[model samples]
Target: MEEIIKVEKLTKTYGSRKAVSNMNLSVNRGTAFALLGENGAGKSTAIECILGTKRADSGNVSVLGYDPAADRKTLFEKVGVQFQENNYQEKIIVTELCEVTASLYRKTAEPEYLLEKFGILDKLKSPVEELSGGQKQRLSVVLALLPEPEVVFLDELTTGLDTKARRAVWKTLSELKEKGLTILMTSHFMEEVEALCDEICILKQGETVFYGAVDDAIRNSPCNKLEDAYLWYTDMEGTADENF
Candidate 1:
């Protein structure tokens, strides 16, 4: 497999506290990779370092054969990012947002077509401020894909969606991978990671505690489910009811 991203001994510190310590990982072309951790587990910090949004005290990060920090523009052009936050203007209509976002890329999907695929085509005239939280989230996602990016980063990609919306989003994401897009996402939901990622990296206290196959993670946890595996990997390793 072709290496699209590589990080060697990546470390990020805020004065004496190490947010991410000695991180090492890579993502190959067309693969789905995940960083699974709880809130404050350093997942965002690691991602910021990787994305060049924040500087690491010491480390090397390369995305698509170029240093993300030094070559942010190159990677930015090639990467589609779906951040958990909505950064678009609130007054803009859904269709306007799509059209504006698509204008940034050399190749873009028609705004109407993308909105249709996302099931919000009829809501195009609706202002972002008037949309529901789930609708906004879905729109943010659709804009991210507007660039036709080769690599995508989805942080907390399914935070507030209802079950049906989540399922729809997941199916759409799966098809992106099938079309050979490399995706890396950070999700606290074990089921989301298991269903979407080809491999998982479990972090504990800012360090990698488990990094390998999803099935192995489950078996290693001595459980039949990914959530159980997460609790196991975190050393809580048993039914929540039993623990409680």
Candidate 2:
């Protein structure tokens, strides 16, 4: 498999606090990868640095062979991102938002097609602010797909979604993965990761404790399930730091 994203010795800090400390990982083309950690475990910061929205204090990051920090203009053309929190204009309707997003990319998928696929086509005429939390979450995913990107970075992909909606989103993403789109996401939902991701990197206190197949993680830990393995690893006194 070809590498689509890479980070090496990536470090970022705020005052005396290291938001991300010497973290490293790689994502392959056409595969789903995940960043797993508790809140404040540097997952978001790592993503920002990887996408070049936030500069790292040290180390390197590359996306699709481009230096994200320096080639962001080029990188943005091929990469899409759905952030954890999005603030839209007070009265912008869904279609208007989609139009504006589509204009930024050289090539785009039809917004209507994506909206309907995500089960939110009815909300097209509704103001973005009027949409429910789950509706907005679905809208964000639609916006991300508009670019027809080769790689997408999803921060907390299904955060506000109900179980049914979450599963629907997962199915959509899984289909996209089958069509050769690379995905890198962060989520607190272990089941989501197990369903969508081929590999994962579990972070603890700004450091990676484990990086490998999800099943390998479960087998190596004392627990028999991913959720339990994740808890055990994150709460362990010493870093497990296993890789395959």
Candidate 3:
């Protein structure tokens, strides 16, 4: 598969503190890659660098063969992003938001189709402020897909969602993956990653501690649960053993 995204020796810092250090990554076309880490582990910072939302202090990044920082106009056209904390106009209705988002791109999928896929079509006329957290999350995803982008970045996509809602979102993502969308996701839900992601990179203290197939990571850490494997790999709370 073609590498749709690449990062080599990427580094970023805030004042005297390093936020990301010598990180390297490659994500293939039509694959889902998960970025996992504890708080302050540089997951978000690394993602920002990749998205060109923040400048990296050093190294290279390419998304869809375009330098993120230098070719944002073209790069962003092929990618969609949903941040962890969603904030949109409080008074905007779901249908109107979809139309507005769709207007930003030259090419787009049907807004109603995306909303229906996310099970948010019923809320089409509801104000954003009147929606529940899960509904809002579904709306966020709907907006992200409005452009019909090939690559998407979703930070905590299922956060704050109930079990049924989370499952619905997962189903939608599975369909997108089948249709050849490359997804990069960050989430605290290990099960979500295990179910949806093809590969994963785990960061600790601003450095990558693990980057490989999810199955390989589980086997290396000798844990059945992705969360436990993550804990062992990152040496969280000193749980790492010599075998790991």
Predicted model with the maximum lDDT: 2
TM-score of each: 0.93, 0.95, 0.95
Model 2: lDDT equals 0.91
In candidate 2, what are the lDDT values of residues 1-244, reduced to their tens digit?
A: 9999999999999999998999888899999999999999999999999999999999999999999989999988899899878989959989999999998888899999999889999998998889999999889889988999999999889888999999999999999999999999999999999999999999988888899999999998977678888988898863333341
Off by over 4 Å in 3: 236-244
Residue pairs in candidate 2 whose N, alpha carbon or C atoms collide under 3 angstroms: none
**Arrange candidates by TM-score, highest first: which order?**
3, 2, 1
Off by over 4 Å in 2: 237-244
Worst 10 residues of 1 by lDDT: 235-244
lDDT of 3 by residue, 1-244 (tens): 9899999999999999899999999998889999999889998999999999899999999999999989999976799998868878999988888888887899999988988888888898999999998888878888887888989999899988998889889988988898889999898898899889999999988988899999999888667767788988788564644343
Error of 2 at 127 (Å): 1.1
lDDT of 2 at 74: 93
Ranked by lDDT from best down, the candidates are 2, 3, 1
Candidate 1 Cα misplacement greater than 4 A, ranges: 236-244
**Could you tell which candidate, 2 or 3, scores higher by lDDT?**
2
Over 131-162, each residue of candidate 1 has an lDDT whose tens digit, in order, gives: 88888888878888888888999989888888
Weakest 10 consecutive residues of candidate 3 by summed lDDT: 235-244
